[model samples]
Target chain A: MDSSQRQLNRSYLLRGLTDGIPIGLVYLAVSFSIGLSARTIGMTGIQGFFMSLTTIASAGEYAGLQVMASNGTMLEMIILTVVTDIRYVLMGCAFSQRFAPNVSLLNRIGTGALITDEIFALQISKSGYIKPFYSYGAALVAVPLWAIGTYLGIIVGNIIPEFLVSALSVSLYGMFIGIIVPPARDNKAIAICIGASFILSWAAEKFLSMLSTGTRIVILIVVIASAISLLFPVADEPAKEAAQNE
Target chain B: MNRITLYIIVMAATTLLVRVIPVLLIRKEIKNRFIKSFLFYVPYVTLAVMTFPTIIECTKSPIAGAAALVGGILAALKKINMFIVAIICCVIVLVLEFVL
Candidate 1:
């Protein structure tokens, strides 16, 4: 390879290492508790690890576990997974745009496999073409971390106190709070959307239990509230400026 | 199908369906200004709805809520990292639960 190409390759590897650390830590913390929760509900360690590897989503995985624990049908689990992960469709689409200019079909598909919300956030913030290898590198580190964390959580869960496990369950919520509150604090429209979805879903769950359609209503609330909020004219100031410059 | 096998199939299919359909449908960059801006805020909204209330109620004591709220606000301002904020909240809850 040429000097510039070699330099690019080196930087990509470094980027992967740096990004992978934080992502892996988050996965360990979050998935560890998820493992405990699954075990608490009677899943074996092998089951939880396989679930994490196949799903790679906290919300969807949790929902699936709830369905399994409740002995809900396979059809219910399938529907829940699809509904909860609808946002990923948009995320993948956006990531693909960033790839379309320079990446080959094989590279795009390969790198796209690793495109989670966190990775998409960091990648989208960067300038210029995305190197597929960097994504592969990040995936190499992150996938193993997720699988290992599940194993560790299951093993550690056997020895940990019940109260401690319960407390750690809150950590997932804590991480989500950390992610959401910062952005919502600055964005009024977004704050409204969040509040609306929560209220609507909460109401549905409480009052619509007799209807035998609680989950679908919750999903509907989220999608409708989010869609309406986006229709409003107020633009995020920083994002507006970024768009203007682009 | 076995439960795990069913899960694997459902998840793989969901991932592929979500990934592929949009890529095929949108032939050009999504230049529609409104849709683009909407997309940007969706995650924030999703996060808030999913996380905010739980932050308030995760502990038995009300004081835990106070600590988490404070830590979350601090983290929001970028005064400290997420680890510090999470630790602050967790410690407060742990200590208070032990004390009370």
Candidate 2:
């Protein structure tokens, strides 16, 4: 490859790494609790590490751990995880639109494998077509930290103080706020959609408390995003041309 | 195979499938304006839906969580660096959980 093309790839990778640092840090903190839960279920630190390594999702893994704790059957585990993580399908659909058309199948598969909530948020919020190198860079930092954090959580087992854990847990939420707020501030339609999301989410939590959190989220996304899209369709843009390199 | 190992494999395979299939299948750009618009707004709505009342219940004390939520929103509105905004929210939670 030419030096100029290589340089561009490096820059996107660097941008992704920089953007991914906060996500990596938050994953470290959040996965610590998952590790602790693994320990409570009598799983070893190594097992927790592998679990986090392979399953980078927070909610799905937590639910899986609960299933293991209860000795639920494999069939039961599959159904529960599919239900819990079905949101990724929608997220993947949305994310697929951001790929430059000529990106290779391998790169697309690799990118899809790393689609956690925070990484998806970071990538989707970017202005135009995204390079696979960016997601690669972010996953480099995020994936390992997540695995190591789970390992540490199992091995360390509650050494961290309670107040500190409480504080750290909210960092993920704080990052979510940072992502949505700026865009909402810039666009009126987006602002109204987010406002409606907040109310609907809260009502679902209060009134539909029996439903799993995942189900509630899926229902809200379909309802709010569809309604908002109908009311305020984004102006169509010409199809983005494939960038020079794969 | 050990039971935990089986569980991990099953969990990982299913989760990865959910994320991978869409990207593999939807190669061409979507033409439908409504579908494109819905995809466009998915990130904002999804993130907001995940953050609300949920954020308020993430901490040891609901009050501390709520205070941090307000602090986080204000900090984010100012367009502060996301990492710094998270740190600010963490501090708010730390202080409130201590005092209350």
Candidate 3:
């Protein structure tokens, strides 16, 4: 590529990294709890941090920690991780189309490593063609932040008293509510979907105690989502309306 | 490899594969109706599943955890910033933990 082209790609990477900062910070907070919990379950700091560094899948990691802590089998944990993270397959497909046709294979893999829920939403929401460099920039900023955050959680959690730490962990649940509530408030369909998941999850856990946690959650999500979508499929976002207005 | 080692390796590899396959293959937003609709609802459902029952268990006391969760939902509903909402949840839990 020409010097100007390379410069432009550099700028894209930088911009993506800038956008990634908030996401990384939030991830650090959530993963902090994961680190602490992993420690509670007997994993060393390095082991927990390495897991965070590689996967960056919050729910899957947390689920894995819980399973491991409970003397669950390796097969159980791995199956749970894959089940909880199956959404990444969909996210990956959506993002694959976003990259420019000519972006190299290695760049694709590097950028793809960072395609979490928030990153995918942010990248897809952008107006222009996506440069692979932009994703690389974002990943570089977010990934290390997540790894360090997990490590710090382990270190700090070891020092803090459990009650205070438990108090801090409340914020994790708060974060999830913060994410789901706003969107649910505006959209009736999303509200009902959340409600259904809540009821089913509680019921499933209570009645289907025989089923594994991972299996219960997977069934809850897929059954509720599929049933809701079949009964009432929400219309797609209005991409065309905005284009006309513009 | 031991079970823990094997578990970590499998988790990392499969999760990586899940994130890689679509980016390497699909060129656009998926057009399949079943997959599209299913994907659309996955986030909300997953979050809800994570939140309920578990949220009740996050704090030192059920009262504190419930209070913080209600506080968070109300705060977010009022269009409060998430960072602030998180802080509010922590503060509510801390204070309630002291009282309860």
Q: Measured against the native two-chain assembly using Cα atoms, what DockQ does each of the candidate structures obtain, in the order listed?
A: 0.40, 0.78, 0.52
Taking the tens digit of each residue's C-alpha lDDT, what string does model 1 give over A74-164?
A: 7887787767666667666556555546455676666566666556544543445556667766766776778777767776775655445
Evaluate candidate 3 and give its CAPRI docking class based on DockQ: medium
Model 3 per-residue lDDT at A221: 76
Measured by DockQ, the strongest candidate is: 2
Candidate number with greatest lDDT: 2
Q: What C-alpha root-mean-square deviation, in Å, does candidate 1 show against the real structure?
A: 4.8
Candidate 3 lDDT at A108 equals 81
List the lowest-lDDT window of 10 residues for candidate 3 chain A: A237-246
Which segments of candidate 2 are over 4 A away from where they belong?
A238-246
Could you give candidate 2's per-residue lDDT for residues A4-96 as a string of tens digits? 878988998898898888788888988988999999988889999999999999999999998999999999999989889988988889878
Tens-place lDDT per residue, model 3, A1-246, is: 889989998998898888678667767766787788877767767777788888888878887777777878777776787777776665565456456777777778876777776666555435444567777787788888888878888777855566776667766567667667776676677788988888888888899999766567767877998988786675564223212211
Model 2 quality (TM-score): 0.94
All candidates' chain B TM-scores are: 0.65, 0.93, 0.77
TM-score of each: 0.71, 0.94, 0.73
Give the Å error, residue A85, model 2.
Answer: 0.9
DockQ-best of 2 and 3: 2
